[model samples]
Target: MTETRKQLLQELAAKNGTPLFVVDHEVLRNNFKEFREKLPDVQPYFAVKANSNPEIIKTMFDLGSSFDVASIYEFKLIYKNIETWPDKERQDFIWDKIIYANTIKPFKVLTKLNPYKILVTFDNIEELKKIKQRAPDVGLILRIRVPNTGSMVELSSKFGAHPGEAVDLIAEAIGMGLDVEGISFHVGSQCNNFDNYLQGLNFTHSILKEVALRNFEIGFTDKEGKKKKVLDIGGGFPVKYTPDVKSFSALAKKLNLEIKRLFGKDNIQVIAEPGRFMVATACTLVTKIIGKSIRDGKTCYYLDDGVYHTFSGQVYDHQHYPLHAFKDGELKLCATFGPTCDAFDTISLADELPEDLQIDDLLYAENIGAYTLASATDFNGFPVAKVAHINRENI
Candidate 1:
């Protein structure tokens, strides 16, 4: 964390009390602008599931950012905000700024949201049939499986259809009278393997080539009415949590080169669904030590918030947030845990902290905006972390 961020967090903690999440809107805007500058041609659809805070959504919406919604509630959230925009801007939001990216969705959600005419993704024929019956006119993107060996959270095993099976899925969609827009695949979350994305892009390119060879005009309409298609590169772009991790700009450079090499200078409508990368570094979680004990010849410091709160990403995303303990005493190895009855609420099994840490001592966790509060639960009587928003001017 920079000195600026630390001071900002200190101010927020002082004002809002402990167990607070401080979101800097300036950081969020800067992150999005950097992403756009790095990949100028790729349209970004912010994945709302990462941190669905309405303030964050409103910030992104004000920046003219698109959204990738997974559930009806998410769509409603974005819809509720974007509805307040100007009439023309609201129409654009209704038509083009959103994509329903969840392959498996509730039937009621599909039936009710079909009138919005937004883009959606599917993996199997059953999903296709459901979409056709419930939401026929919406644009469709086929979700294909790709390599995800090095990712922390492997999504391929659970989602995405095999490449061999996807060919028929496209053909079936065309046969059943569906709007086949393009192809999409997720390499995995926190994916460090650039090869996985290259492989997925190549697979999508080949599928488009095959469809073109068969004279199918669904996904191949270029800007000049020739040959081009949309490619939804599902998000897995890594953020710099630790020094060993590859920076976002480095990965973006590699992916951009591969995209140019594979598709040439064609006017392909490329888009990315970025969740973690968008908001991970934009917020910090501040929690205070409530109690401490020594067990099994080691120190254990309990925090007011844990896996059931803002640090939920530790259990869900397999993340070890960078922790900073505030004290001048000698350093000692300590274990951090949430203030919960469950033994599994440990935040870090092995962490270093100041030996003189007291009950009110605070610990700041950085890069915790994603998959944290969004997946948090009130398992015991403990409450969710209160969010404190810092606008650009304020930050």
Candidate 2:
């Protein structure tokens, strides 16, 4: 941990008080650089689902990350406050850059925004039929939703077709003359086992091969560093919020090797929609020691950060982020909870808190950028955490 980051968070806490989030802009840029350095062959479209803050998005855009919109709402959010919002400029806006509307079942509002360069994902022939009727002018990228090899905590058993059927779906789309540009897949979020990643890339490459064999005009290569005229890997380069989760960079290398072996070369222009990894560690939420308790011989630090407002789906995903006390001395076991009403809004296990904690004490958690703010709600009518941006200069 950079001393400056620690001090900045402390300073932000001092400046904004409890229930606040501080984002390190430099960490985000470094993350993008590291991922690109490792997979320099592929272009990264910053998955905005992780952090929708205009500041963070502007930082990412300034770092040269492309846009990967999963929904129209996310697209709006990305451009809402940014100076480069596409149509707001009002001139042949669809030609600006590649913005993929990567979600299934887009509404008419979504189609109305800009369907020219907007890529839609078709899971089945039904959605295919709907796209033809709903948004006739749009090109489509089929989202090949692969199931959890039971390797991930949650399964996307709800989305996409089996690998065997994905080929036929792509073929059907081609037969319909739907503007099929490229293919995509989601290696289950928070995946630990590397084999799960290998399987997803294999599936996508297979479909791409089928598309190639069909003599489709789809691009398989661009002048390296140029726009990928090929396939995309959605569902991110996985980041380990938990200490025990596998390394995302290692998995990327492994998948890159598999991709080379399959293609006999690494020329495919790949687009990765990485949300969790890029931003998960770029931000941390800080709260005041509004309250504390001693229960079952353990110190419970109840900060003002609401669990629903901070980490809504974290526990359900079995993420074990590092917990730390403010004083930063000897670590001890203690329970940590939020100031929510249900009494179930705890962010950590009962064993994570320190032993010497006291009333009005401060604490911090790490690897908290991804789902922390996006899922926040005013449920208990609690005011959400305030935010502060940190730059590399400070670090």
Candidate 3:
């Protein structure tokens, strides 16, 4: 961490109290800009499920971001934000700035979302039937299953259809009188293996050609009625949470080369659903030791936040945050536990912590902005960590 970032985190903790999330808009803007610069032809739709703090959303909106929403609650949040702007300024966002990326949704939610005419994703025939019954007017994107070989979270188990089934699903949607506008797939979250994406792209190319050969009018069309296929390579773009992971620029270069080789660069309109990459490195979680003791001959510390709070990513996303202790002393092995009553609320099973650390001593975690707080709960009546936005205008 930079001295400036450390100072900001200390100041935020002093003012907002411990167990706070310090978000820097400058980092957020730089991350987004970096992705766009490397992949010039791709449109990035910020995935709202990563971190739904209104401040983050506002910063992204000001930078002309489109969104990837997964639920009715997320939809309402983005819709209401766009509603706050003037009509002329909001037209860009209202028309085509969002995609409902969830493959499964309740019938009532689908019915309620029909009037918006937003784009949505589905992976099966049953989902197509539900959409046909409730919201046939909306644009449809088929979600296909791809390999999650090196991803921390393998989404294929819960989402996506096999490529063999995608053609039939799209045909069924077309037969039901729905607008089949695109195809999508996730390489999984926190995926470092680029081969997963390469395989997915190859499959997508084959499917597009197959659709074309069959004379199926899939995907959106231009004014001249030319088919404009939307290729949504869903987000899993990893960040530098650890030294071993590949950098975004390196991954982008490889991806750019593959895209050019396969589709001749920008032949098909491309989009990405980036959730963790956009905000993962932008926010730091600051927590303080509330109690301490020796357990099994190792120093054990209890913190104000844990599994039901900001560190929820450990249990949910299989992530281990990089921890930094502020106190100065010889290092000792320590186990950090959360404030929750559950024993599973362990934050770190083993950490190299300062030996002189005591109650109220501050410790921080880096690159925790993504899946951390988004799924946090009030279990044991512990409140969620407060968020403080910094470096806004500097962006």
Q: Each prediction's Cα lDDT score? A: 0.86, 0.68, 0.87
lDDT of 2 by residue, 315-390 (tens): 5445555566667566667767778777888866554655666766666777788877887787888877788877
**Predicted candidate 1 versus true structure: per-residue lDDT over 219-261, tens digit per residue:** 5443356645678998998988888887888888988999999
Distance from true position, residue 371, model 2, in Å? 1.1
The alpha-carbon lDDT assigned to residue 365 of candidate 1 equals: 85
Say which prediction, candidate 1 or candidate 2, comes out ahead on lDDT: 1
* Residue 147 accuracy (lDDT) in model 1: 96
How accurate locally is residue 35 in candidate 1, as Cα lDDT from 0 to 100?
Answer: 88
Q: Which digits, one per residue and each the tens of the lDDT, describe model 3 over residues 1-395? A: 77777887888899999899889899999999998899898888999999999889988878878899999999988898767787765654554688999999999999988877588999988899999999988889998999999998899999998999878888888889999988899999999998999988988988887887877888776546676778899999998778899888888998898878888843477889999999999989999999999888888899999988999998888888856887668877789999988899988867888867889989999889999999899899989999888888855
Give the winner by TM-score: 3
**How are the candidates ranked when ordered by TM-score, highest leading?**
3, 1, 2
Which consecutive 10 residues in model 1 have the weakest lDDT in total? 219-228
* Best model number under lDDT: 3
TM-score of each: 0.94, 0.87, 0.95
